[model samples]
Target: MVEGETIDTASLDGYVPFDSERQQAYIDAGYWRNITFHDVVDRHAEEIPDYTALVGPHRELTYAELAANSRRIAAYFVGELGLRPNERVVLQLPNCTEFLEAFVACSRVGVIPVMVLPRHRSAEANHVVDLTDARAYVVDYGRYSSGFDFVGLADDVRSSHESLEHLIAVTDGETSSVDGCDAFAEMRDERWVDKYGDEVSKTDVDPSKPGVMLLSGGTTGLPKAIPRTHNEYVFQWERMADAADVRDDWVAFPGVPIGHNASLNCIVGAALWAGATVAVEPELKPDALMAFIERVGGNYTLPMPTQILDILEHPDLDQYDLSSLEVLVSGGQKVPPRVVEEAVDRWNVGFCNIFGMAEGPLICTRPGDDVKVQANTVGRPIAPEADEIRIVETDRETEVPPGEAGELAVRGPGYFTGYFRNEKENTENFSDDGWFFTEDVLARRDDGNLEVYGRIKDTIIRGGENIYAPGIEDELVEHSKIANAALIGMPDDRLGERPAAFVELTDDATELPLKDVSSFLEERGIAVFKRPEYLEILESLPRTEVGKIEKQALKDRIVDAESK
Candidate 1:
């Protein structure tokens, strides 16, 4: 017999849903709750209308106001623009209260928002628009903070993608300058809601339907769309809220673009799930971030480790009243132990290391976890029963015993069923039975913590010895002179490939030679084969928008430099 609600996958377009057996298991285990994203907001609005839901550099919004604005915009989407349920819209905007408004508004009307990063150029935007067949393109075009014409980009996408029907631009000015674009204010105007409030209130959004589409961040190719149903997405963030011990009175600051999966799920979703307030700041520089946190009384934040290092390195760090910060959370890449150490020592705040992906699977260090665990491991799965973690051999047939590194494979309530519209990738990345091969290398400790060894493709083989790059990079950053480190396997004729170190020195340090790096690892008892053979001092490492090291860029640079 079918269990609980049967998801009609045909209606989802390219979105894959849990099968009958898996659906029953999740529902029986109490993991799958039939609830839409907006239900949570409406609940909070009714319970705490006067409570602050969101705060930005420009304005503050209470839960009642937030819900009212979302309902208003949602009414405009359906009643005025004629957007139907399940229709897709490309939402490209920076961090602000309006981003939340637009996101929840999409949820309220059962429209799916295709989250597009602010840095996405016409190439990326066009790719998303074409893939999703989005009917509307929403962008924040007022500030010109990045000095790029987002309106022009929208026009270019609308011209090429035949499915795009409407252009919505958010501007501070009373009127919109762009032709064929609607002002955002029209959608949220009080009068519009008063007219169509009854019609929007009667709309029914299925909890089992797709809520949002997150772009994949795979290293090799163009990003694929990751479809998350409302039930699963809600479950994912609620687990995060529980794991991080989020309190309703807390203020959350996410020092990354809201489009990133980590920022969306961890900071925004989890915080709001617990009825906490989210603090938004478009500027991510150290001083700006610190001042924003202080101004908003932000107690919890998730910034990439590099951002934390930058904050620690800032000359005016001591001047900022960051005493309100209670927890500093970081993820996406291996956080240096020194960074963790300094944060705890200086700020007296809890530091949590999280391991997650757009396709689900959230593992995080809790608030009271041992400092060594926080520094060295990305703690146990947040929901042990729901998020089943495994370390499997290269063949993907057998599980590796604890303490041995292998590919991380997961299959459970917390993982996405498959990538949207990519049948080849779906078959290749998932097993016949169901596991999603994460492609990341990890080793489980006896104590239940998991140590990340970086990506499986990043392994270096020197004279038949398999060496993980992240392990060496982790050790390299512990050196007094090194501020940041990235390890790449450089081409070598003698040994298939040799590990090379790309390092950024600390503020007070000078030059560090290859011999010094090798000797430091030797003293640290790192395996001789894992030592970096060559060293290159760089002013800064190339990174993605989310702060992950761009190793491919470094590899290309090293190859060209070696050839020259």
Candidate 2:
């Protein structure tokens, strides 16, 4: 869940705060709990209003119909799209129930959404609507069983952004209008929820501003905006739903990308701030997510070790009835400890291990850790006293010694108060006394957990989709038969990595297949899971005597041609 892009408004002077003695030491260590995510869906819709909060693939909402469908889509985004409060739309919907009623109706009307990924088209949705000047783009009305067309890619990103000016969509039946957009079934019409469903009162809301922007799977271009505020995502989804014990009669499921950031701060913002029950299922198919967890008794999930090796190699893996799961976790990359010891030796299911980042550092592995330290550590710091974690050494202040590996960094009330309007990636990824670094690498172990030693930036990650490699090697040397490009990441026991480009040609080029580099990165709109699944033609790439590119000598020539 390493996505990227950024921008914003609702004035906290457009943010990058955290300095009043690091925001009152994260509000005196109560981890800044000033509330607001529509005050946890209006205090669980007045305390568990008939529980079952959201199931999707058709229906089942309660928590008073997910807080009255997020206050009737926050009164159709401020009384029929006049949208204000800090306006900045762009959602790009998909794990439907209108993507959690337009992400909790853009946090009950202080609109800031900007998520971007139903496999983003139109050059990463017109570079996140030219970095969040977004005044509505929404989507989800037709084609995407790879027929592509998300409402004709949000009308070609609203005819190449005219400050976008509303487009909406999200429908399944006759709410009519499809091309001129605006029809999330007319905001659940009860005559527009009786004229703006009490327009989202409680003094508009501030929970220390920002409330959702996240994108940043960045290492080079097109992805850089990780805002995340509402009191730092309610202290990172209620301390990662109390470090994955997540109960309010848990059900979860979040098979990733319900606007990611590890499915919103680890499983639908910790199952809607722990009132639990999320479910959703539009695609991440392991026999349709084990038939939507044997038809919805889900019992928690997270899946991303190549979807736990495609649901432990589904050859109809014992024809469903996953014994109501009860915890699985896994995250972006680095996770094979036998897929956490064969999904906890089959069915007693506990699994675990997370490690996040949009611009924050979530790190998990809890629910009673040891299955070999939840298959080789990742645990610890689900706010270990409001995050500090260092390790260091390529001099981001030196430290690195105790069983060393380096790079991780951190520093936070769930880290992020930078990179919104770039300022050169907020000064090359923050650290003049603020930290964030995370070019990964890790290693901590003497029982304090950590481990995963890899990345000092030049990401790839594949099936859990990070894919940076110089933004597809700057669109593979702008292709005219390429003259230099590199990409990388090959080993894929089911997508734990895939890309592999390499290039070099152009001098009356010769050959370059992998379907002409996946139809020239799908006509340059890119994201068909960031294209390039193998295409090595290089007569020159391995550089570094100062020229750089020797990507570990092209990953030791795909590990010496897969050991012959």
Whole-model Cα lDDT of every candidate shown, in order: 0.86, 0.75
Looking at candidate 2, what is the lDDT of residue 234?
Answer: 82
Query: How well does model 2 score by local distance difference test?
Result: 0.75
Top of the candidates by TM-score? 1
Report lDDT (Cα) of residue 283, candidate 1. 79
Q: What is the C-alpha lDDT profile of model 1 across 1-564, one tens digit per residue?
A: 112323345766877777778877887888988788888898899999999999987789999999999999998987788877778988898888888999999987778999889878877898898888999998877643656788889998999978999999888765654578988877878887887766677767777668899999844457799988888888987998888888999999789989888899988999889999988988777888989987888998899998898899888888889999888789888888788888988988887798889988788888788888998899989888668778999998799999999999998886788988899999999987789998899999999999999888888888888899988888888898998899999999989998999999988898988998888899999988888888899999998876788999889998999889
Q: Which stretches of candidate 1 lie over 4 Å from their true place?
A: 1-8, 218-220
Q: What lDDT tens digits, residue by residue, belong to model 2 across residues 1-564?
A: 011212234353445777778878778867887877877877988988998888877778888877777777787677777776666888877676777777777887677787887765788788877877888887777522434667787777778778888887766665466758788767766565577665555335566778778787532357777778788888888888888878988789778667778777788888889898887887766788888889888888887765666577667889788898888887665565656877888887776687787777888788676798887777888878768888887777887876677688888877887877777767876868888787777768777888765576666788786766654675676677876677778888887888788878876888878887788789878888888878889778765211235576787889899999
* Residue range with the least summed lDDT across 10 consecutive positions in model 2: 1-10
Least accurate stretch of 10 residues (summed lDDT) in model 1?
Answer: 1-10
What's the number of clashes in each of the models?
0, 8
If scored against the real structure, what TM-score would every candidate get?
0.96, 0.32
